[model samples]
Target: MIELPTLYHLATPDAWDAEASDDYTVSTLGRSLAEEGFIHLSLARQVSGVAEAFYAGRDVILLALDPHRLSARVEFEQVPGVDDAFPHLYGPIPRAAILSATPVPFAQDGAHDFTGLLPEPL
Candidate 1:
């Protein structure tokens, strides 16, 4: 399987404070997500469609998102069906967070090809 990004953590801007009981508008990004209604910041773009996927009824490997793109917080471990402090495992790492993303397969010139990598044992 292609090893684009091995791990990922959710991303959101800190526009809102916990003390405030209101939601911010993410429509500025593109479209409002159906479930959480937050903007998908639009930074996950990649060679594979799944890698650059939005959060509308879908799950994409984010690897790491940038602090500039962080408009709000995700309330912690918001990955559907995944409960607990899972997000904490990655901590507050920002977009530049280096990850084991897969190298681009098949160079545009078609002369080079990515050998790919082995999956890290979880």
Candidate 2:
């Protein structure tokens, strides 16, 4: 199977702090995992859309995760009417899985831009 070099997860400051701990076994989506049964994630190409839909005007840190380092299973599933499949983590994302954490940049109009957050396309 082909592996994506990186995946993105938009997280709050608290979540970022929690994930920084060695004991942090769960990813930032603890509540989502328990309630929705999976942690929501996005591909590099889908980042902007997801951010606009859910994280607009909010201060969020983008998590750059290495799928290879993830202890939990990562699946790419399609959403209704969406052309591309999105990455979903079946379990909590271990901190080690996160290669880097950077604040999502915003444009003058208050729109979030996800460009340059990841390395070259996979």
Candidate 3:
């Protein structure tokens, strides 16, 4: 199988901090792993769109995850009404899997400015 690239998860500061265990249980902005059945993830190119659509005008932290470090299985699945397949984690995210967390800055127009947030080749 082809190796997955770095996966990104958008999370609020409070929610990201609340996960004090070895594994993170929160699935998305307002959902949980148990409730959603998986953690929603994005590719480097999808970060800006996901943020604008779901987290506009909100303070969020961008979590860069290393797929190899995660205990959960990451699957690329298609969602209705979306053209591209997104990465979904089948289990809780392990703390070890998190590569870095950076605060997402918003532009004056209330849009998320993801400038330089992603690594090279994005």
lDDT on C-alpha atoms for all candidate structures: 0.32, 0.74, 0.88
Whole-model lDDT, candidate 1? 0.32
Best by lDDT: 3
> TM-score for model 3?
0.91
Which pairs, if any, clash in model 3?
none
TM-score of each: 0.23, 0.82, 0.91
Question: Considering TM-score, which of the candidate structures 1 and 3 is the better prediction for this target?
Answer: 3
Ranking by TM-score: 3, 2, 1
Which residue runs of candidate 3 sit more than 4 Å off their true CA positions?
120-122
Error of 3 at 58 (Å): 0.6
> Tens digit of lDDT per residue, candidate 3, span 61-103?
9999999988878889998898999999999888888888899
Judging by lDDT, tell me the better candidate of 2 and 3.
3
Weakest ten-residue segment in model 2 by summed lDDT: 23-32
Error of 3 at 114 (Å): 1.0
Higher-ranked by TM-score: 1 or 2: 2
Ordered list by lDDT, greatest first: 3, 2, 1
Give the per-residue lDDT digits (tens) of candidate 2, residues 2-33. 74657888886666684355523333434556
